[model samples]
Target: MRVSSYVIGAPLSDERFYLLLHGIRGTLDKVPARTGAFLVENRGKPLVSPPWDSDDRARAHLTERGYLTDLPEENERQLLVEVATALHDAALALRPPSFFFVPAYTCNLRCPYCFQPHEMHAGRGVYAKIMSHEQVDDAFRVIDHFDRPGALAEHLDLSQEGQGTADSGSVRRGALGLFGGEPLQEQTRDVIGHIARRAAERGATLRAVTNAVQLDLFTDLLGPDGLAELQITLDGMSDLHDRRRVGPRFRKTFQRIVDNIDLALARGARVMVRVNVDRSNADELARMNAFFLERGWGSHRAFSAEAAVVTGDAGRETLVTRPELVEVLDTIRADQESCLASYEGYAHGVLSRALSGRYPFTQVANCGAETGMLMFDPRGDVYSCWDEVGFAEHRVGTYHGGTLHLDHEAARAWLSRFPGAIDQCSRCPYALIHTSGCAKQARDNTGSLFAAACEGFQSYFPRTLATIYEQVESCLLGEAERPGPRPPTRTLPIVDVTHGRTRPPRDEVLR
Candidate 1:
C-alpha cells in the first residue's frame, strides 16, 4: 500500500495543533501537527508513509481520511493519468446553463490598469458595435444543440429532490450572463434588453457585469425580468476612482456609480461591487467597505463585494503578496455590520467554493475554460474562455450560420494541456487541487501556458484553511447569525498614497 501522491500537507501558519490536508478542490481535511513530527521522526516521507500500525493514533486517523491507499508506486502516475482523462471527458460532456456573450468590447472607462490590451478596448477609431439580435439568436441556437451538462444545476437549478424545474433544468437556464466592455452603455441597452427578455421568457436568469454609470438609464431592466445582480466596480471614492478609471466619456462616474448602486439596492436588485486594489487605493479599501456598511448595503441579501488585487503586465504594481490582500479583507470583516467576515471574502470563496463543488482534481486541467464552456465575442468569434476572447491566436472556433465550427485539434489542445505536460505543474506540492491557475496569465507573463502560475494561492493557503476551520467551528458552536449595523461613518481624512505610483520592490515572503 502507498500513500496517494496527490494528498498535500500544508502547515497552518499560526496553528500549532493541526496541519491541513487539501484532499481535493472541494474537500479539506486536517490531522494533528504531531502527525508531521511523527512521520519525520520515523523518516517516513509522503507517498511512502508508514502503515496504520495499531499503536499509532495518527496513522489510524490518516487511514480513515483516505490518506493511505493500497496503490503500487510504479502504477501511480499511470493511475493519475487515467483519472485526469476521466475528469477532462466529464467537463467536456456539458455546457454551462448560460453563455457569457460580449455584446461589444467597448467600455466607458479605459482603466489605466486594465488587463486587456488597447486593441480589445473601444475608442481606437473603431465604432462600439453591439451584438445584433440575429447574432444573439444564432448564439442560443448553437447553445441549444450542444450537449448541456449538469454543471448549470450547481447554481441555477433552484430545485430540490422531487421539485420541478424548467426544462432548461433551471428555475431559469440559470442566467444568460451579459458581459462586455460595458453592457449597460446607452447604445447597448437595446441589445441587453432583448437578451434579458428572452431569458425571462424561458424562466432563466439574467445577469450583467457593468460599470453602473448608466444604470439609471436602464432601471426598467433591473427587476424580475432583468438582471438579478449587476456586477460593477468602484476602485475608491471619486478622486481615487476617476484618476485611475480615466475617461472623458464618463464624467463624475464615481458618484454616479454610487448613486446607481443605491438605486439598484432600493429597487430590490442585488449589486456586486468589485473593488480592485493596488498601491493607488489600498489604504481606502477598508474605508470604502465601511462606507458600504454605513449605507446598510453591506447587510443586503444581494450585495456582494469582492476585493481583488489588481494584476498587470509588470508585477511591480500588482499585489506583492496574497497576505497583503488578506490584510485589507481582515479590516473589512472586522466591520460588525458587514457579512464579509462570514463569507471570508466575496463571491466564490471558501464556503461558497466548497458548496459550489469542483472536479475532484483528476489531472492538470484548471478551470471551466479548459472545459467546454463557450464564449462568443463580437465579430462572430468563439473562445473556450473569456480571457482568450480578444486574442485572435486563442480563438478556438468561430460562430456562423447558427452553428459552432470549433477547430478539433485546437480545442483538444486545451483539454490535453494536462498536468504531466508541464513539470512545473506535476511537481507542485498541491498540484492536485491547484491544478492550473490561469494558463493564459502564465502564457502572457512567461510566454508559456504550461508555466507555473501559482497566483500566491499556496502562500495564503494556510490562513484560508484556518478561516474555513473557524467557520465550521462557529457553526458547530451554534453561534447565532452575527449580522449587525455598524457605526456611522466618521470624518476620516484620506491619506495620499498615489505619488509617482512607482511600486516598491515586491516582498519575497510570498511567491
Candidate 2:
C-alpha cells in the first residue's frame, strides 16, 4: 500500500486540522491532526511500516477517500487515465454544443500585441475574404447537419439515452459566437443580421467577441432579441487603451468604444469587459474600475470587468503570473476608498467554491476546443482552437461545398488531448484543475501539444487555497453570530462531476 502522489495539502487556521485535496478523486477533506501527520509521512512512498495500527480509523478513512492505494505506480497511472476518461465522457454528455464563426481574419485595428497579427499571415489574401451570404447559408447547413437526428451523438461519440438525441428537441441548443477579425464591424452588418436570424431559427443564442469600435452599428441587435452577450476588450484607461488598440491612421477610439458600450448596455446586452493586463497596464486596472463606477457601469447587472494576462506577441518582460495579477488587484483594492469588488482573475472561481464549501471543478481538458467545439472561418475551414484558426495545419475539418469532410487525424489529435493522455500531466498533482494548461501554449512553449504548460499552478495553489479558506471561515463565523433567525439552508444539487467536482459517478468510482 502507498499514499497517492496527487494529494495537495494546505494548513488550516487552527493548525490541528488540515485541508487535503485528493486531485484524482476530486475529494476535499478537513483531516484531523493524526490523518494529516500520516499523509505528510507517507505521501509518494510505498509503506515500509504502517503509521497506524490495522484497526485505526485514520487508515480506513484515508483508504476510503483515495489517499492510499494498494497498486503499483503503473497500475495507479492506468486508474488515473480511467478516471479522466470517465470525467471527459460526462462533460461531453452534459456540455452544450458550441460553434464560432470568423467572418474574416482582417481586423480594423492593428494592436501591436495582437495574437493573430496580419503580418504573421504574410499578406495571405485569406484574411481579406469576408464571409458571404452563400457561406452563411452553408454554415447553417453545417449546423443543420450537426442538428440531425443522431448526428450529435455520433459526431461527439456520446451514447443516446431515450429521447436525448438531437431530434428529440429536449436537449437545449448551444451558443453561436461571432469572432474575428472584429466580427461586429459595419461592413458585415447584413451578413451578421442574416446569421443572427438563422441562429434564432435554430434556437441558439447569438453572441460576439469584438473590440466594440463599430458596435454602434449593431445597436439594433444588442438586446434580448439580438446578441445574448458581448465580450469587449478595454486594454486600459483612455490614453493607454488608445495606444494599445489603435485604428487605421492611429485613430483615437477610446471614447467611441466607451459610448458604444453604453449603447449596448442600455439595450440589455451583457457586456464582459476584458482588461488585457501585463506590466504595461497592470497598474491601470483600478482606474479603469473607477471609471466604470463613475459611469455607473459597475452597478449594472449586465456588466462585469475582469483582468486577463496578456499573451502572444507580448514578450516575457511584459507578462505577469496569475498570482501577481491577483496581488495587483488586491493592492489596488486596498488603496481605494470605494467598496466595490475588485477585478477578479482566475482566482474568482476558486474563491467562490471556497465560500460555498464545495470542491473546485476538475478540468479534463483546457477548454471547449479540446472537447467538442467547432469553429468555422469565412473560407469554410474548421478548427479546434480559436488561436489555431486561419492556419491550415491546425484545420480539423472542412464544411465546404455543403458537405462535412473531417481530417480524421487532426480531429483525433485534438479530441484526445486530455490530462490523462499527456505524459507530464498524467502524474502532476494539479492535473485535475490545470488540465495541462492551454494546448496552444504547450505547443508554443515546449514544441509539443502533450507537454505540460505549468504556468505557476504549483506556485500559487497552496497560498491561494489557504487564504481563501481563512476568508470563508471568517465570513461564515460572522454570519453565524447574527441576532435574527438563521436563513433557510441552501441545498446544492449534485451537478455532473465534469461541471464541478461534487461527487464521482456511481458506476465509475474506484474502490
Candidate 3:
C-alpha cells in the first residue's frame, strides 16, 4: 500500500495556513503548521497509523482529514480505467455541444503573422467557400441530432432530475460561438442573423468571436439579450493595432472597432477585448489599458481587457507568454498608480477557479473538443475543436445531405483523453485538475496522442497561486501597498514543446 496520487501542499494566504489541496475527488484541508509538516513529511510514502510504535498524532489528524490514503498498484489501475470510461460517457451526456459556426474563410485583414491564410479558392488547398444556406441547415441538423431526449440530463446542471433531453424550453445553454473569416461581414449577416434568431428561440445564448470590424452593421441582429459576449481582438493602441491587424488604411479600422464595441456595450452585450500580444506589442498593452481608462471604458459593466498570448504565428509572436504580459501590466500598474481595489470596480473577469469556482467550466477536463463540442466550416466539414479550424487533415466528419458522416476512429481518440486515460498523467501532481492540454498541439508538436503539451500546471501555476492569494490577503487586510521598492517578479521556465516524458503505447494513445 502507498499514498494516493492526489495531494498538493501550499500556503493559502501565508505560512500560518497550509492548504492540503486535494481536488474534486477528495476534500480540501486547511491545517496548521505542525499538521502541514506531518503531511508533507509523509506524502508519497507508506502510511503508518498513530500509536503503532510512535505516537504521531499529526499523521492520525492528517488521515482523518482525508489527505492520507492507501492505494495499491492494482487498485489504482482498475480505478483509472473506470474513471476514464465515466469521463468519456459524461461527454456524451453534457449540455448540447458548443457549436462554432464559420460563416466564411475569407478575412478582410491580412495580418502577416496570421496562421490560416485567406483561402479564396481551391488552389489554396483550404476551403474558402462562403457557407451556403445548405451548410447552415446541416449545422442545425447536426446540433438537433445531438439533442436526444434525456441525453444531457446527467452532464449539464440545467437539466431536470429525470428529463434527459433538451427541448426548446430547456436548452438553458447550448453555447453558440461565431468564428471567422469574419462572422460579422456584410455578406454573412443573413447567416449570422439566422443563428442568432434560432439561438434566441431555443433559449440559448450566442457569443461571437468576431473582428468587430462590421459589428455595427449587425446591431439590429445583436438584440440586448440575444448576443451574450463579443470576443474581439485589439492588438494595442491605434497605430500598433493598425500595424499588426493590417487592413485598408482608408477604412479607419481602429475607430470603427471602438464604435462597434460601444454599440455592443450599449446593447448590454459583454465586450471581451482580447489584447493579442507578442514581444513587439507587449509593451504597448499598458498604453491600451490606459486608453480604455482615459475613455472611461473601464467603468462599463460589460467591458473587459485581457492579455491574450498569440499561439499560431511564432515569427510574429516572439517571446510571447502570459507571464511576460503580466509583468508589463504590473510595470504599467505601478506607473499608473492602480491598486487591486481600484481594479475591483473596473469591469473585467479573468477566468480563475481559485477565486470563483464558476468561470468557463469546473471539471477535470473543461473543453468539449473531444466529446460534445464540434465545429463546422464553410465546406461542410466537421471538426473536433477550434484549433483545427482551417486544417483539412483533422476533419473528423463531413456535413453533407444534412447528415454528419463521422469517423469513429478519429473521434474515439479524442474521447479517450482524460486524467486517467493518459499514462504519463498518472504521476502528474495536478493530473486530475489540469487534464490534457491542446490535443492537436500535443500531437503536432510531439507526434503522440498522449503527450502532455503545456506544463503551466506544474511550472507557473504555483507562482500564480501565490500571486493571487497574496493580493487577496493584502486586499482583505485593507493594506494599501505604499510604493517603495517594486516586488521581485518570478517567471516560469520554458518546458519542452516537442513531447512530454512518456508517449505511452500506440494502443493506449489511440484507445
Top TM-score hit: 2
Candidate 2 local Cα displacement, residue 49, angstroms: 9.6
TM-score of each: 0.77, 0.83, 0.77
Clashes of each: 3, 0, 3
* TM-score result, candidate 3: 0.77
**Candidate 2 residue-wise lDDT, 1-511, digit = tens:** 8888777777776778777877776666787756665675567788656646565687888889878888777777777787787666555554444577887776778876766765532325656677888888887777766643344335645444532443444444655778776788777788899898888887777777788898888877788667877777787888898998886743787888899899998998877666667788888878887888799887677776655566555676787676686677656655653222221222345446644667665447566666566778888898877667778778988887677777776776666678888878878767777677767778888887878777667766755566555555666778522211112111111011110001111111100
Q: List the residue pairs that clash in candidate 2.
A: none
Question: How many angstroms is residue 369 displaced in model 2 relative to the true structure, after the best TM-score fit?
Answer: 0.9
Q: Give me the candidate number with maximum lDDT.
A: 2
Computed on alpha carbons, the lDDT of every model, listed in order, comes to 0.57, 0.66, 0.57
True-vs-predicted CA distance for residue 301, candidate 3, Å: 2.3
Ranking by lDDT: 2, 1, 3
Residues forming the 10-long window of minimal summed lDDT in candidate 2: 492-501
- What would the per-residue lDDT of candidate 3 be over residues 411-451, giving only the tens digit for each residue? 65666566666776665555555556657667777887677
Candidate 1 CA-lDDT value: 0.57
For residues 55-127, what per-residue lDDT tens digits would candidate 1 score against the true structure?
4676666556555555553355555555554554444333333366778887777777765655556735432
